[model samples]
Target: MARERLEIEAPEVAVHLDAQDPESLRRLVLEACQRASTVRTDHEPLVDLALSQLVRGTPDDNLARKLEELAERTDDRYLTAQEAADPNWATLFRSARLASALSLALREQTRSSVLNSIYEAAHASPDTAAFYRDLLL
Candidate 1:
């Protein structure tokens, strides 16, 4: 079966939940925090150093530093997006690169309606709306 899109509307101004609601907002936060706690940090420092060592470039030190920063950020970006969507690492990574391209336009925080702009730009994406599809779910 095909997976649905990752939806990102202007989240409701207020999504009402009753006191007894099991699916309340607090529950969702608790669940997310718990899941995040399980991802291992044991190899974190070594991974960081190894990754840093492998990411080198540019004629200037500043450019080299900037490139390295980008490399480091892109590393597990796919995995986080996968947390939003599918486990397919390939598709997720493609979406991550796409989102990075989208990130510049995203950085200008004006209204809360970034989703609409993202939706509009989806088609122009390097991966042809893959990240938008990923976000729509």
Candidate 2:
């Protein structure tokens, strides 16, 4: 008789949150967002816009519409002309486009949790924490 070998795989670790303490969870999120903002600069402005909109309780549909309008306004011709006229136009346009996309994603509620939705749009994005930090400083 041949002996059979059994293969065992370790389960993936799940992040457990203490739902009872909303305040603590908020603090943790703020801290994480702040840290993430410092490291990730590519979409800082967009992240900031999304967080600010979320904090302000902006309606998803309204936010989406506004973002879409802004994105539409930043057409290829306008961007190309602006880039030609000013060297910083590229950076500004990139940030605008990113912000617009974030607004749409948030409106879609791609993630279940509010924080998760914002973070998914732009990981570790922080505008609220930064605002508080600036105010304190």
User: Which candidate gets the maximum TM-score versus the true structure?
Assistant: 2
Residue-by-residue lDDT tens digits, candidate 1, 1-137:
53112133322211221122433332332222222222233333432432333222111334334433543464486566667675654443433333322232223322222332233234323443443344333
Candidate 2 lDDT over 28-57, as tens digits, reads 334433344343334456567655765554
Tell me how many clashing residue pairs each candidate has.
7, 0
Where in model 1 is the C-alpha error above 4 Å? 1-58, 86-137
lDDT of 1 at 51: 31
What CA root-mean-square deviation does each model show from the true structure? 14.2, 12.1
lDDT of each: 0.33, 0.42
Alpha-carbon shift of residue 126 in model 2 (angstroms)? 16
Worst 10 residues of 1 by lDDT: 11-20
87 Cα displacement, candidate 2 (Å): 0.7
TM-score of 2: 0.37
